[model samples]
Target: MNKKRLLAAAMSVLVAGSMLLAGCGQKDVKQAGSKPEGAAYKFRLAESNPAEHPVTLGDKKFAELVKERSNGRITIDVFSGAQLGEEKAVLEQVQLGAIEFTRVSASPLGEFNKQMSVFSLPYLFDSEEHMWKFLKGEMGEKMLNDLQPSRMKGLAYYTGGARSFYSVKPLTGIDSLKGLKIRVMQNKINMDMVAALGGSATPMPAGEIFSALQTGVIDGAENNYPTFVAQNHYQSAKHYILDAHQRIPEVLLISKVIWDKLSPEDQKLIKQAALDSVDYQRDIWAKTEKEAEAKVRDAGVTITEVKDLKPWQAAVKPVIDKYSADFKEALDGIDKARK
Candidate 1:
């Protein structure tokens, strides 16, 4: 072969190889960006309700927002009514990267991060304004950041409403609660607070509350208005005392597994959507509480609005003191949050 002809053949071979490699690179990029055939990137979200609750509403809204913002690139499937199992089970699944998201009360989270006990403190938040300021401020960010180490990410806070007292008999004042068996969340602060308030605190799952109340296992239970009405505990415990004791906020959480898989742009979208949903849910919750209070009142349940929070606050002071010693740093943060 002539030398020029041989060089031309070699150049053609190199060009063909370069084109093949470029084609493969393009194919890989396409595969990475595009969804697989007949399959969506299903994000499994779980909550402990049947879609009517505020948390479920928030979950549904979050899914809708993600679908809209991602242009259908991401899809969230929510499992409500503990279908994905109890809150603790779901939380463990999230930690192991098996589940995508959940809305959990801070009580169970207290078992994981002791700092969460701060929220369980009775009378910690003075009012709705004080609660919002603390949660949307630096203190809230710090608390949210604290969850990262546990493989959980705090997205936003949902209003669980103010914890109050209800009884089979009328509870006119704090003294009326003396020696009564009051059902409380499975938390030390809650137990102690009820005890200090003159009720014998009984720790039980919320699901068992109605049965407990019905069977005289517990004479009363403390929770927000929505829970009291939704769970139908009002039938048994007709007297609703508006002690407004603890304004504990429910937390919306995402698994770090699903979070880390998100692109930075997608992360920003999800966070913003969650914040907006929080505000939306809070408004809905406030309205719901009003409706619930009115409905329960019409059902012949007496609603007593306690004026003297000082006695309630004074009673639970030892709870604060004990927690302060055990959780000094968190207490310090709460003190700063109040400012």
Candidate 2:
């Protein structure tokens, strides 16, 4: 009986030792982005423009980079053409964490973060180069960070090219815009800008702009060249005035709720990917802008370039001066960037 007991005890000890050794040999996988090993995460990105648009393409590139860097651990699905919602509605969804990501015009964001309205000021940047320099610098970082309080985090800025007025009638100069009803974004700064320029402001969503112009609900609207072509606004509003008034950028944002849940490493990785995609977007945007200009001209659309902008600048100076106090820091930073 004693011999049998000794043999049984020895067998149990060997089995226990083998189990411990097996565990030691196993690799440890740290949880990333609150996800477990072999588990993948999927996110949705909201883009109001069509798939072919530069901003949408940029978002896709960002997703591609993230998926490649994460080795299939993370994937993002982009819903273009406002499949998720219009700009404002999508932004609200992002803030509530109902959606994961979105790329929206910085103009509309003024409703959420007052500082964002600074971008809407007429002639804020001396040139596209000046605008990009400011957007990629420290002040830009602060402006992006300012969205945190609104329950969203700004990821990166995409080029909006230059915003200009296009109308059913010829927009020859500041005098041409007088008394015309201009469609503007749903923000006070844009409304005020239209008002300051001596035009009646009609606030509406992007999707509604084409019909509004066709039905004579609005006389004109202001946006980048790419938007004018992509949205087919040039079909109805045949006159484009190249005043290059505002170069408001489009901003990518993630829900703060979702951002807080991501691992620090994952957050850093995603931000770097977003920043890298900016170059891709900017390149395509330049090419597209040129193509759009040619297309519009070929379509018999009247193109008016204001060589002397002093008159237009003077006309909108009151709009800028009125809001200067509210955005002193931004204005100061912009001044520094001009140099």
Candidate 3:
């Protein structure tokens, strides 16, 4: 069999093993639902990235703050590297209260909250500064609060920086994208964005990206500097373009089912800790992203910077127009934030 099929079969077996383990540990995991009054509580936090990634660092920091603030009454174990499951499966577990918490990209979240898909729309944020402005204001809080209906609580937004196309093939500019099969998240807007840019979109889980690139199953993928380096996609995809197509934020979420069981005081404490962790995460994220770029360059990868986003932006205008009506409020808010 070819490498792509072999990798897929291996991952399938691993996922099955993880599910079997979860089944055996269901009783212990469900204990998170029953917190005794004024007693110690132990829970799990799922992260798909490696333990050393910035988001995982944020997850650990958040857990540390929670433990310290709770005076040892609350302790969280972080399961990184998809030890629990992939993003979608872990999200389902969180929704069912089987998993207490998870840190996931905003892309997969569109499945639960349609409003989330708005973030995946191309060029939605003029810059990272604009994104933070929207995320830290009323609109951001509203977006978080809106998650109650989905059985999840959005605590705070972690910086994911900008996502650009990286490929095994050299990407000179927008024209280089034509005929390339780029892997994208399973979000429709993301798929549409790639299609509008003249490439075929191959939707797959994040875990499958590295192998897909190595095996020629996909020619390119889009993501931020930290992710391209952290996930080691840079190793296989030697060309990086600074298109900054989308700046989707990663969210820290907890199961509302477990959250509702906590005392209001505890809830307040946890939320505050999560918010504080974002500040810590942002500091490291900036540094890590810079270092990531330098590291990849040292490895002899070609990093292309786009001089004019006007053409790229113009190309995806149809996609923007198609989704404009559906996300009028979000688009309007984003527009207002740019100033």
Per-model RMSD to reference: 13.7, 13.9, 5.9
Where does the lowest 10-residue lDDT sum fall in candidate 1? 31-40
Candidate 3 C-alpha lDDT tens digits along 196-245:
99999999999999999999999999998888988999999999999999
Candidate 3: misplaced stretches above 4 Å?
1-37
List the candidates ranked by lDDT, beginning with the highest: 3, 2, 1
Instruction: Report the lDDT of model 2 for residue 320.
Output: 87
Residue 19 displacement in candidate 3 (angstroms): 17
| lDDT score of residue 80 within candidate 1 | 85
When 1 and 3 are scored with lDDT, the better candidate is: 3
| Structure candidate 3, residue pairs in collision | none
RMSD of 2: 13.9
Point out the higher-scoring one by TM-score: 1 or 3: 3
Clashes of each: 1, 0, 0
TM-score of each: 0.85, 0.89, 0.89
lDDT of 1 by residue, 101-172 (tens): 888888878877778778898888888877887888777877877998888988888888888999997899
The worst-scoring run of ten residues by lDDT in candidate 2 lies at 21-30
